[model samples]
Target: MNPKMSSPKVGFLYPGYAAEDDYPRLGKMVNPNVDVELIITEFNEDAHTVEALSEMGSNRRIVDGTKHLVGKGVQSVLWTSTSASFVRGLEGIKEQIATLEEQLNVPASTTALAFVRAAKAIGAKRVALAATYPEDVALLFKVLLESFDIEVIQFASKGIITAAEVGTLQKDEVGNLAVENDCPDADALFIPDTALHSAEWIEDLEEAVQKPVLTANQVSFWEALRLTGQFTPQKGLGTLFKQELPKEGELDVIKS
Candidate 1:
């Protein structure tokens, strides 16, 4: 770690086939000063339904994995799987984050909630969505983003049902879907699935569409930056990371 870098330990609660290298690699690209450690949960082969994802991230499993990361001195913990986190909706997401904060004694977040904050960071009101999740899971994500005031102008997905399949999806396919689904009138384009391997694709896709592209893992890194109070804007990553959130206690502004 560089002496001048702010070394905040981050915990990632991930699902099977978790791509650990991509996250820190992406983090360094956006902010080279952070140290990210991952704690993966056990995800079964069949994760196509809300019930299955909920079971995969049950209190017992998440608490166990989260405690291990807390033991390692992480200051913030994030549940990095969109399906596992959003299967419960916004309120459920809130409950899970609260649980992690209480059990691990650290600030916590999930990929879905991270997306909400990420969109707000960039001052985005209308967004286009892309996903690799099953239809039900993707709809849940859409509903949650809407709760955070993001209007879904357009939507598309690959319909990948399994965690393994989502993990193996090609970068080209992800970027293509984003470009195709993104609306010209939308303020930003969002791909809210952590399993989609989006770190390498976000920059190019943003250029292809000429708009801000947000992926679940990218927003996770962005949200971690905010929680740590390190808000330096970086270029070429995306509009969200390149802009700061509104100041504390300011009235929220509405976009037309």
Candidate 2:
């Protein structure tokens, strides 16, 4: 067993209308240690307008939010919003990470980047995706993932347009989407919004599809584990988290 030291503390910067239950589940999966704090932001609800999507106060607000957690001695911070991370474009996500790292002087990454990094870390050259966004938004996400050399093997969008509705979606609906859109050749599957709670359904989805089922929440959790150099096979979450920790000679993707 890994040494039972105090687990790392992480702060999650949530965009408007995000699920409140996710951070605790992440702490439970990390197990025995690691604090997870939710830092929610105030913003408009509709996801259709550029003003709402751009979220004027977002960039600085996230930095200030994370700094609050860092002051509490949190080891790392993650911005856990898909629309805000992706809608502004991939470079925008990079800029967000840059902003947080500069403020807290700690390692930081956005959920959008974490998703891409996790896919590559697992050697997922071909991947299937299930999104709750509309077709146009889903296509933008597809383009983002493709930039990382992970091919989109199959995709299906739920056509949900509002941020609030996305947060309230049922777990069974997400599980069904994972099962239906899975592709035989895909190395892994991804569900791409932190607002949508998917931590509870990943294992079942992996079993049905026979591949690593990664959700936005799952990868964000995984990235925090990497930041703290903690990797243990966690049951009840999914294949990705259930993966054994790397030994001395093994290629550690989390480190690399």
Who wins the TM-score comparison?
1
State each model's CA lDDT, in order. Answer: 0.75, 0.74
lDDT of 1 at 49: 81
Q: Tell me the spans in candidate 2 whose CA falls farther than 4 Å from its real position.
A: 48-51, 244-256
lDDT of 2 by residue, 1-256 (tens): 2676667777777766556577777787656656887777666556744456667336866765765565777677788776667777766877888887888776788777788777766778889888878877777788888876779979888888776787777877777788888888889988887778877777778888898988888888777766666666677877767666444533322221
For all predictions, the C-alpha RMSD in Å is 3.4, 3.1
Clashing residue pairs in all predictions, respectively, total: 0, 1
Point out the worst 10-residue segment of candidate 1 by lDDT: 247-256
Output the worst ten-in-a-row residue range by lDDT, candidate 2.
Answer: 247-256
lDDT of 1 at 20: 50
Off by over 4 Å in 1: 1-5, 249-256
How well does candidate 1 score on lDDT at residue 18? 45
